[model samples]
Target: MAAAVVLAGLALRFQVPGAYRSPQPWRPEHVMGLVYPAVGAVVLRRRPRLVVAWLVWAIGLLAALQVVLQPLSRWAVAEGATGAAYLRWAAFWIYLLEFLPLITLLPLLYPGGRPPSRRWRPLLWLVCALIAVNVVFAALLPMRYTVGPLRVDNPVGVALVGELAAWRRPMEWLTVAAALGCLASLAVRFRSGGPVERRQIGWLGYVLVAVLLLGCLDMVVATPFALWIVPISLAVAGVPVAIAVAILRYRLYDIDLIVNRTLVYGALAAFTGALYFGLIGAVNLAVSGYGALAGLAGALVVGLTFQPLRLRLQRAVDRLFKVERDPYRLADRLSRTVQQARDPAAALTSALASTRQALGVGGAAVEIGDRDGGVRVHGDGDTADLPQEIPLRWHGATVGRLLLPPGRHDARLAGLLARHLADVAHAVRLTADLQASRERILSTREEERRRLRRDLHDGLGPTLAALALSLDAARLRLSTDPASVSESLASLRERMIATIGDIRELVYGLRPPALDNLGLEGALRALADDLPEPRVDVVVEDADVAGELPAAAEVAAYRIVQEALSNARRHADARQITVRLRRETHGLTLVVADDGVGLPMTADGRVPRAGVGLGSMRERAAELGGSCTIGPRPGGGTEVVARLPLSSARGAPAT
Candidate 1:
């Protein structure tokens, strides 16, 4: 059909006289007729199901027919051809057919090329009936219609041509009604459409509105023929191109951004121009001979106001378009929520929700682990099948994965979301670590309480009870026999002395008394003196080390040294032991080395099960945000080294 239309048009143009066929300014309607169907051909090749493509192609062919037949009929009448009357009638009917679809069906079928609803189908039929009536009356009217410079009579003449002409007014009104109905249908579709569909209609609407405005201007003003024709023509031609672009969704996501920037910048330019002119006029009125100065001042004002005005205009445009899913705005919102959120899980959920809303995807999620450990997911719905997954990293480790539904891929938005999630994940992991550490500290404290209770109840209580009985017996014996009373009194005194030593030992086990009285250095020195067996040495690198250390650091250092010495005495059987305390800029360091057998290790290179003491030492340091390491010394003995950060210790209470 397209080929036939094009060939017919070319043939008719060639057949006209050379004088009448001089080069003419391009006509928008003819250009649209030529190009629209070609675009439709491309669209149809890819999407054969689209009804819009077929309708567009048909419209293009109809336009071509009108352009070809109307001129040829006029040439025939002008030359007084034998069949000129029949030719003119045929052209008249064709002209009616050409415009009927455009005014009645094109808008109704545009975008998706279907009625807005089942109810609208009846409206379609009504438009068709109106077009038919109008065509019939136009054919039967016995009027000599002028075709260009030639007059031709309608072949099928009616006796009541005046009545038919009077009836034509109602038909014309109905055609206008149908055209309005088509526009209404378009509006309905736009209101009910999705993002992609709305964009398609929006592009077409923009072009048509621009053309309409230009036509209105042409009517109102004495515009030069050249001035209105070119722009008006281009705007009309743009309609089909815009439709094709929208249907294909080529750069669809960018359309909103493009339209937003254009509206903002366009309005800004117009406002700035008006302001410049107003300022120039004011300045001329105020100060006559300073036109150049006024122009400079106007330019300065525009430059100063440009950014603020653009921002305001952009926000206004966004509201007009009802755009709610701006990535930058979403990022800002998530950032603020994360900062204020007390719970990491809650923060993650909020962030994912924002992501889903911003991207307009099916769902979104954050999965923290693999299948074996059982995935920990946050966000709405199941995201196992989501197409895109961005890895969230914290401290150079992949903490989790962010999942998003399939659609137009936005790499920039994805990166921003991933970075935001990574921060939240890091905070969540730290919170988990802190909770675990607190639990361990509570457990250790409970164990120490049980141990203390056992010592007081089983050991000290029984001994004290026995001593009281002995004293009672001694008191009874003193009244009867003098020798028995002396022996009993001496034994009771010995028992009482031993009880005092046991109580002191129990108190020392709970906390080093030397640490309370003499600080870390003195406590380590006293510990060395108490160790029995091989010789022991205590070295203090700085005199002010103990004084500068926080109480938690002081206790942690003392306990670590004490535990190392006990371990060496019980397990290592070292010949000699060395306890060293060094003060650094950030913290205090304690190293205890023994010339004894090193730690027992299993085949898998793990410490023996009896190495709970080593773990206890590590826990102590960790509680104060420090570290403890136990390994073999370079000289074939065990070395236990601990570093305690003074700053961390100052923040944390001594355990």
Candidate 2:
């Protein structure tokens, strides 16, 4: 296997127009070419025992295929010591037979199959002993190249060749049985939720199937040609093709789009090139009578032909590579099916059936993660013998896994199917999360309204009632006693004013009426009017902030200004506060500045500004999908600037 790979690497690197020799034999490119598969094969290296076993088997098989055939062909042509050559090559084949037992044991070595009884090793040893005896018998055989009779002319055990040849006919049937067993085993394993095992087993199965076909083709073709030539050459071709299919993961999953484009565009290019070149040649031949004129005509023809060909090829290439809904047509169909499904069961059924068809897996199922650290079988149609649980994951977190039974073809098909299912699971989980969030938001909103109504009834109602009683008492006393009535009236008047202030504050707390009445400009003006200290300057320009915004947005903008003003009055100690409201192209903007001692910068490279109000203001602005910033002004003050969307501002009531 290594030699074949090395030769192939050399062939690619040499790019030698000729078949045999160029600097190709010793090129560094060949060495680098071997590096990729070797590095990739590191995954197998984790189980060094298994890897070494397979490596030994591959080596033995390759030796039988190449060493005996290549040298025998050369010796046949040389026609010297031909008898000795045949005998030596036959010995090499005998030594290679020892590798066959390994193939039978390979699947058993996997963590599958029932635990073997104690007699398993003895049976294995007995098989090995028989293989060794057969090898020794074949190695002792003698041969002669010149064909006078079917039996060779050499002395030592040449008759054994005839005996072995007869034996191979029945053994061929046994080999066929073994091959079928391998396919069945892989299919059963795949359906058993063993994707990784299936992938490796599947590759071997594909190669064996191809080998069987080639063998059959050789037997049919060998009557006319030579029997050895078909098996040696065609069988060799099968290995690399199968390996390429496995290594490149060709047509495994979503990469079918790339494969389709490559095929279509490549064929188009070849066809166009052939047509253009052929036409050019034919025109040149026909116009030769005109001599130099013919040359010009041919050139014109070439030029005219190229534009159409290039344009067609370019269009084909463009279409091939274009991003469209049908990139992986089968996968896309499955995605749409899942999207349109009414419930998880339907989605899983569609997904499993479609994925199994798309990937040719034996069985498939969706495993969902439970709240506890365990997984549950969500939906699937896997066979009874398959594993109950499959490892599922999203990102780095294990979500769940799909268990697929053994497939009809390769085990690798299961792995390919599982990967796509994992993505689908992640997307479904995200959709569920979004739905939960929306429900929570609705529930919280109702609860908040209930709490606000309760506060109004339980807190402000008594205060207002007491103030009304106090005024009534003052009215009753006024006509009875002049001095007493005057004292009662003064007390009543003070209490009534205070109560009114409290009621107004409470109403504003629930929701600002200014915002509801006249939009953001009116609301900011109202806020400025309500502030008790530090004469505030209000500037309103181009404040055509109109249109309805979300309810949440209106409250956010109003609250931001309220909080910023409160902070300025409490901390800035500024003599004057300037407030501005205006409309920009995208949204409404607000700027508040106070000419007070600016926010202090802390010693730890942080701003020491008290954010008692800023955090709530920022949160409010963010809730509206807007932004706010509070920082020191250039002219010895603090500036609070905010931008809220116009769509949100419109929903605020006019102040």
**lDDT of candidates 1 onward, in order:** 0.76, 0.56
Tens-digit lDDT track for model 1 on 181-300? 888887888899975677777787777678768878999999987777789778766766777788886644455566777788889999999999899999999989999999999999
lDDT of 1: 0.76
| Cα lDDT tens digits for candidate 2, 35-80 | 3234325424543444433443343444434433433433343444
For candidate 2, which ten residues in a row score worst on lDDT?
20-29
After superposition of all CA atoms, the RMSD between model 1 and the true structure is 12.9
Show pairs that collide, candidate 1.
none
The C-alpha TM-scores of every prediction are 0.54, 0.42
